[model samples]
Target: MTVPSPSAQPNSLRRRLMLLAVGCTMLAMPGAFAQEVAAPATVLPANGDEIQQFCTNIADAARDQRYLLQKKDLEKLQAEVDARIAKLEERRAEYEDWLKRRNDFLKQAELGLVDIYKTMKADAAAGQLELVNPAIAAAIVMKLPPRQSSLILSEMSSDKAAVLTNIISSASDSTTSKEPS
Candidate 1:
């Protein structure tokens, strides 16, 4: 093979060196440009009105949200209050019914007591000596008025009067014994 010329070899080496340098410079330029473009030194604001409008819009949205929450809370509170009122009304009605029943029972008891008193008074007047225990005699005496006690005593038999007097005396003695001193 023929040998290449020295001048041509030198020119080819120079061209390769120039191409490598140009490629490295092209890559380095893009990196530098990217860094400069990423971080700009200046900031722009179009108008104060735009920022004010944005803030007002945000505030209005927040106020509407709060109002909705408050309304829901009020509704819940009203429902709870209504339920409590209904419960209280039901309880009141039940209490009134209970009171009425209690009154009826008391009236019946009073009527029974009156009937028993009348029977005992009639028995005492008939001189039912066999039926008159101390307890029955005492109940008969208690039912009689203070002014009527003597009449009832006169109507009763001697044995019944004696038994009642003994019971009363024993009760008095027991009460006196229970004194502190």
Candidate 2:
């Protein structure tokens, strides 16, 4: 075989050196390979409030390059948030109105019960136990605290009060028996 010329030898040496340099750079900087492998750079929108805005801009630009999301999807998400806020405000107003009406009704009913209790007591002392006993028992059931009402019923005539006491005892027993395990 013929020996290679000196000029050819130098050219070969330079080519080998260039290849070695590229290999060493690839080993030293792995990110260089990704840069070489990816597509061209893209421009992004300028307006941004923070680093997240800048990152979002870059992500949007990347997505546009990749043909991902359209503008309509972004608008739809914004509309959904707005609708949820409006619904929450409407529910808050409804709850406030319900609370006001409930308080007013409870106040009126309590006053009416107090007037009935006064009338029943007046009739009971006038020897109208027959008429007053049932009214007084009903008033005690409706107006007095549960424990106090039970005690008062226990002290009344056994024949009449026994019925109210049985009702109360049965209610209490059912409540206790229905407790969750």
Candidate 3:
């Protein structure tokens, strides 16, 4: 098969026929032969009003996004603070409960020690108490009735009794000072 050369003749019948075929094909599928036309010249705002409006819209959108992000951050921080506060409140409540239990235990022990001293012989109790803390011995003696306290004091050496008496006096003064005015 031999390929035909392009016709140089201006009015060649074959060239006219080829041109007609191409025109028909281009018309059949307009999109395939479509040219990119320049967009219609936009009428811009001469007074800068439209430009300012567009800038304002962009700024408003940016500000809204920033505000939303900040709101989310603040909410997270608030939730964290609330969680910390809840934990602190729980710890405080636990500490208060433990303190109440400790105070109750100490009071019961003080009463039990007072009872033991009341039941014991004065001389032996005095001797035993001398071996114990002076504060504890004084507290126990103070809980006793006047006659019992006098008997226990009499059994104790004068110096020891004097020491116990000073402790009791100071303890009483401390307690009095702590009372609401």
Tens digits of per-residue lDDT, candidate 1, 1-181, equal: 9988755586554445444544443343424334433321133223454355435535654566678889999999999999999977876676666556545533443544435555466445536533655555554455456555566666767777777767545543423322242
Candidate 2 Cα errors over 4 Å, as ranges: 1-70, 110-112, 115-143, 148-181
**Model 3 regions more than 4 Å off:** 1-41, 110-113, 118-181
lDDT of 1 at 66: 77
Q: How many pairs collide in each candidate, listed in order?
A: 0, 0, 0
> Between which residue pairs do clashes occur in model 3?
none
Which digits, one per residue and each the tens of the lDDT, describe model 2 over residues 29-103? Answer: 425667663321243222233334435435644555445455677778999999998977776676666556545
The whole-model C-alpha lDDT of candidate 1 against the native structure comes to: 0.54
Give the Å error, residue 44, model 2.
Answer: 28
Best by lDDT: 3
Native RMSD of candidate 1 (Å): 24.5
Tell how far residue 178 is off in model 1, in angstroms.
40
Pick by TM-score: which candidate is best? 3
**Using Cα atoms with residue i matched to residue i, what is each candidate's TM-score against the true structure?**
0.38, 0.31, 0.39
lDDT of 2: 0.50
